[model samples]
Target: MITCQDILELQLDGVELIAGEEGLDHPVTWTYMVQTRPFAEHMNQGNFALCVIDYVRYDFEEAQRAMEELYELGISGFAVSVMEDREWIPQKMIDRANELALPLFYIRWEGASFVDIAQSVGKIILEHEIQNKRTGDYLYNLLFGYDINDRYIEKISSQFGINFTNPCRVGIIVADRRYGINLEQDEHIYEYYANYLN
Candidate 1:
């Protein structure tokens, strides 16, 4: 579970104070100031971001670009340092992450409150985005199966959103992994196919 102290430590432990060293120790409410900035007034609390790729190419400059853009747009997101070489993750990257101060959502704690809070916000935003994008194209493919309806191939759409498109036949994927841990990328298939299996 995420404790207040855990948050303080994860953030403080990874950061390197550059210019705004004060921001690190600053109250979480100072996030409000970031939210109100000209570029990001539209952003609000409980907003979350997820960034995925071949963590190999993850770079400090890339992190900076993404953070600056999101800050302007008023969103809160944290990047996972999935890389091994500690040297690759530079002070600027740490500084940038600290400035933006997005939550680290990749790790799991049995009952971390702060992680749960961030996830709740992120899930809502993603769900809304998916709802807006489901222009009947998804349901059609979902029922008919994408391979059978190949001619009707559309831009690969999202199930849980965030651009993970999967084509489901009449099969449900059952995993031994824990609940939320295994739910990524293939839920719609389970929605229909699970009934057949269960």
Candidate 2:
């Protein structure tokens, strides 16, 4: 659940918030560069739309409309680059953003480009998703015997740098619920077990 606030922590240069400060905590599902397409098919809940602002630079109404449309689709937020000596973001756009509680920000892009921001954010999200998938698979296998074949086992072991030939054992540690082991604690325990097995 990486949120706009998480992305902001990266402190990208030239990027500034124009409105919707309250929406910073909303979780971002993915980041994508905006294109001419309608964006309905590509947009999903928690999407962060990144744009160059070239298309709506001259039209304030269009920019406001675009923000409203994106908000309707459950987009997490929007990021736009405001190049030097170019048109600035419209006040209406900022107003609409605050009204909708959608996070909106402008990137100065002094030397950095929109692609750089998109790539960095996308990479963080991609890695998070991959880690989550691996966790889910590992938990599933642990709870329900290894329902996979040998080939699958070999692949998993190779990916995780585990040697199948070595002695392996699974230890189930039961925690007292009264002690209140949170999810973060569980992950640490899992990690400890994984390292111990290796």
Candidate 3:
């Protein structure tokens, strides 16, 4: 549930907003900093991509293309550091980002460290993960009767967003090792297992 707006509110190292105001609400699941080529293929949905254009001379055209490619790859936003040439990012790139509604940020290389931004975003992601794990553990305990009571069940279920009124069933499956069937190799394994359970 961490969004670009949350990062902006952090006011990380006085980071400046460049464009894409409409995408402030876009959800960010993770943050990645890249200075190398071929970045988009490695990214995931809801990723916040940070471009470090650190070379003595930078190619604005390639940077623009990469931004568009990252946006198409489903990134929530993009951040870039100022080039060595002292040129603010080009107006066309800002216009393109605005047109695409992909949030853009300008963090000067001297003004902020990548570690600072990463740590701030990483904290939010880690907290969400920890909360999810806690919810899962609570559900497991309740289902297995670690503490079984109407009050406890209702409270725990609501906390984890589980609707107890809905009919539910628990299932367990033991895979046979003798067959040497690799689930990854066999597309039919899921159907076979379902048929066996039924």
Q: Against the true structure, what is each candidate's TM-score?
A: 0.29, 0.65, 0.69
Per-residue alpha-carbon lDDT of candidate 3 for residues 7-80, written as tens digits (9 for 90 to 100) = 89889884878899999998787787655556644566677888866554336777787788778778899998
Ranking by lDDT: 3, 2, 1
Among these predicted structures, which one has the highest TM-score? 3
lDDT of 1 at 194: 31
For residues 119-193, could you state the per-residue lDDT of candidate 2 as single tens digits? Answer: 778888777667666765775684597456878777776765555697857665554333344655455345433
Better of 1 and 3 by TM-score: 3
| Candidates, ranked, TM-score | 3, 2, 1
**Overall local distance difference test of candidate 1:** 0.39
Give the higher-TM-score candidate: 1 or 2. Answer: 2
Prediction-by-prediction clash tally? 5, 1, 0
Superposed model 1: Cα runs more than 4 Å off: 1-46, 52-57, 85-88, 97-198
- Model 1 Cα lDDT, one tens digit per residue, 81-104: 334323344566666555555433
- Model number with the top lDDT: 3
lDDT of each: 0.39, 0.70, 0.75
Model 1 CA RMSD to the hidden true structure, in angstroms: 18.0
The superposed Cα distance between candidate 3 and the true structure at residue 56, in angstroms, equals 4.4
